[model samples]
Target: MPTSSVVVVSKCSVYPDLKSTVKSLKLSVSDLPMLSCQYIQKGVLLPHPPLSSADLLSLLKLSLSKTLSHFPALAGRLHTDSAGHVHILCNDAGVDFFHAKAPHLSTEALLPPPDRDIPPPFRRFFQFDNTLSFAGHVKPLMAVQVTELGDGVFVGCTVNHAVVDGTSFWNFFNTYAEVAKGVKKISRSPNFCRDTVFNSPAVLVLPEGGPSATFSGDEPLRERILHFSREAIMKLKARANNPTRNPDFCAPEILGKQSNDSWGLNCKINGKITEENGLRKDPTAVISSFQSLSAQLWRSVTRARNLNAGKTTTFRMAVNCRHRLDPRLEPLYFGNAIQSIPTIATAGDLLSKDLSWSADLLHRNVVAHDDATVRRGVKDWESNPRLFPLGNFDGAMITMGSSPRFPMYDNDFGWGRPLAVRSGRANKFDGKISAFPGPEGNGSVDLEVVLAPETMAELENDLEIMQYVS
Candidate 1:
């Protein structure tokens, strides 16, 4: 079979020329941690529209300019002051936009079935590799690539991670989509006030050369998409909260497939299982839908890797601190306002526990992050600034970065709603998994799993794990 090919047609800088007096936006405490992290490289795939390729491209570019008028910081570049503080110089620096073509690629090829690997041709729509976030000092803070495929189109955006997180990134994307459809008023504009995140001014000192992006961009891995239906999630949630003797639950740990102990003993006490006794239930720890799924994935991946029983396994997830704080933040707060929370357990213990045990473990940790926790975290970072440790260096860590709650399918750029969402090859490691909401908005989820070929093979063959995967 002939592989798909992408030919870059043109690259240009797009300026908003807002003619405003806003000069700069300082990097917040939430943003500084991402200096070493790779850019956010994600976009959507759409069906072929009625407009000719030329007209569609022109409309996209023009609307991008109009959209940037609301997000001036995106058209700016990063800067470092004498005291080592970083800022986004809102100088209308312009965004890097690219035009590309993949004449032989089709939607079917770009989106293979869940069992197959995602083709590399889809990644060609992205311009950045594992470029560090600090590179925004010289490069465009945001880069957009529009590729023309055989039957449809792909619009991929690469935004500096230090500037916008998943929430702010999608805000801009949805805004751009509305602008493309001729919406004059932006429904949600980014709020640039720093006080929303901190009571006092926040300054971040850079490491001597800043954080290093250690990815080689050539790791041999399988990019597998795991789709779980809404019904599957509801079933998982019910299994975790309520008592059940069903043998169909996913998660090797919960099924007692990885251990010698009986699953019933680990899950139940004295022939009765309730929220009280099933999970050593923390009265305040209410297991969430996503936490159950994450716990299951953690267990599945651990079993797939076939790690030693004594090995330590850790799971980290990005938590949105917007509504968790006391006063709460502005809904449209720009820049980063998220934090990573980690939960650790021994492989032996995690696998020995029941489904609700791990699910409640995640829940307790998430619920413990309150007002004081956020304040204390900021204080600690102020004393010692560091870049986000994104990669899974030891192969025993699972990092879930994105959320399945983001309104991704709602973006319609005049043509139609997106058929699917895809990401680039930036900051992807062996155990890194990005979760996206299903394109149908039906409470389903799609997890883009990146792992070694051997582990992926093991995970694929793990029959119990494959039960929940559609």
Candidate 2:
């Protein structure tokens, strides 16, 4: 299939001016870390457009403009203050929209056999290959690309990471779908206020131009969009909740037994949470689909790498902090309110522990990051703010991003439910995994896993991980 070329790139402005209403929105500590990240590029693949390319684009452009009215930051510019802090100048400048056509390409190209890697054309589906989130200072804060396929349309959107996180990004996407499908009223109005209930601003001066959001494109990686069926997920969840001790499950030798005094394992138990010596001991202690799946992935990846027992491995998760606060941020609060929590354990411990044991570790660590924890992170950053470390720093780190909770398949621009979800090569590195929900509302999940060539080969052959990989 020949790659698609962006035939046209135009500016799509918001419908009404909002400068008077929102003069300038301040950047929060959470938003600052993303300055080092590239634009968040993700979109859906809808089959068979009912209208022609021109006709469909006109409707989409109009709907997108109206949608931008609700999300001014998407159309605004990033402004830096004298103190070196960043802010959004809500001037309604507009976002970049690109139109493309792949005359020889077919939708089938993107939907390859489950055994093969994602087709290369999916990389050409978006326009922002090198644009960083901080580049919003001079470039459009957002960009959308619509590609006409033989049997489908690829609606790829790239939003400034410094402006919105995954939650707010989907909010704007779904709102556009609503308006495009003829919904007059905005379903979820965005709240762009950066003032939080546990607020503390981290104003750090920049070095040179700003943090470079570059990822070496030269690295060879295997990006697999693995879909886990509801049944497969249930199997993992069952294993995570079961107390049947397997001969292979080994207790940690050096770390000894796990401790339970902090916050009483505020973790999300499958049914009811009961604590025993800092851990859940119930044979029926249920675990969630995400917890089960993530823990399994964490363990399987570690095993595949075949690292030394004493080497430390880390799991970094982007946690939402809105409702976790004491007072709680009001609903629909926009901007980045996420804290990337890094959970650490020795490779030996993760590999030796039972599935439930590792899941419990992930659960308790997340639960422990409550209001005070979030506040302390902010103040610590204020003392010395730094850009996000975007790679596998310790050669044993796995970073989990995007959530199955995000409404990825809800991007039905009146065409129909999406056939699948896809993304571009922006800020991608080895050991980075992104989770998306299955098309049906069942318990199934999809993981977009990126890893080195050798690791991916070993992981694909790992039967334990493959047994539940539907």
Candidate 3:
């Protein structure tokens, strides 16, 4: 779609709280050179009456300048290195920052179909037209794309893993929202003071030495994160509470059955094959039998646990806490901060155990990841000099990432928000699931799954019986 002309509203002022927060950030990390991975990008929808090209440019500059004025910390990236010279690569001439392409205004595709059985993580590259990419790993990493939709637009933005966690990302976004609205007061301020939590050299030791020691032998012997349809979750709920059956069935009860069925001999991994009964016997029979028994035991515990009573089905939301480190660094501070949390189940848990059991289990696991115990472990390791080691888990697996759809869709650059947004380059992982805004503010989530054709086909074949968990 050609860039349409829409008169966009401008947020002419930056909030005071945001202004001070940015100022403090700049002061705390003043000595360090700006890392290349910390840039931020945004999009916003403009109703009818878009601005002309010239007017749009002017508005973008005006908004950006004002934002920086209040959030001077952003200017750190534009700063020089220890040699008193800014990195040449930070200049526009060095980075490939450009507007990306968007699907033209097409009524047919406006409401994309809901994806079923999105494989694990990286396979999601198949669902869209473009993806974010990079040439070399750099600090304060950045990627941007702006595409014109027929009546709308789509914007894509990405920051490197080295710098900033999700909280920082949203912190920046909320700042933009307040500034764009010309609000004087910001609801929250970003906390990046690393010293409050860590001495510099101590903070520096985490990325270098901690992970390997802590995570050794800590990897799950078998682990998989799965998804179910909203409908499937409901079905399970009914089965657990069937008055005609056992009113005693609870979340753990339902989950015991579901987990066994889901993970038992039937689950295919490591190229292992199963017989018609979802088992493999003979010499391998002993091993397969153990697997079956383990599944049964775990399920039994789930049923006995009654974990579903008041729980809400939720997405396993993972947030990296590396940034929460003491002696707060700039948004550009690099390294991992991925701390996982569950979105929290909003729907009833005990009642929907059958339908939502899987979702519930996943949600529970995710929430458990946030225990102060887990974080303390992370902090303890950070204090050491070894690089944080990834548990036995491979970074390249079929997994889902937090969706960018909600965050990147409406970035305004003096123009209007884009019509839609999506991700770029499929990552190193496999089955990738992403979430975007549902159609017409219906409050439903539109999920995009990218998976191997075989995995997708298997899921499609079972769609009728699929239940969405959290």
lDDT string for model 2 (288-326, tens) is 557778888988888888899999999889988887888
lDDT of 1 by residue, 1-470 (tens): 14348889999988894753578888888898898888999999988878998898899999999988899999999998887778899999899999998878888888777778877876777987768999999999999999988899999999999999999999999998999989878888888887665533556656576668755556788898999876576567656655454534433454332111111123332343324334435334346668878888888899899989999999999988887888888878888999889999888888888778888788889889998898888888877766777777777899998888777876899879998999998888899899998776556788999998999999998865588888
**What lDDT does candidate 1 reach at residue 219?**
73
Candidate with more favorable, higher TM-score: 1 or 2: 1
Candidate 2 minimal-lDDT segment of 10 residues: 254-263
The model with the greatest TM-score is 1
TM-score of 3: 0.50
lDDT for residue 360 in candidate 3, whole number 0-100: 38
**Each model's total of backbone clashes:** 0, 2, 91
Q: lDDT of each model, Cα atoms only?
A: 0.81, 0.77, 0.34
Question: Total clashes, candidate 1?
Answer: 0
Per-residue lDDT for 190 in model 1? 84
lDDT of 3 by residue, 195-244 (tens): 43322333221122111222223222211223333233323333322324
Error of 1 at 175 (Å): 0.5
Position 447, candidate 1: lDDT? 92
* lDDT for position 141 in model 2: 88
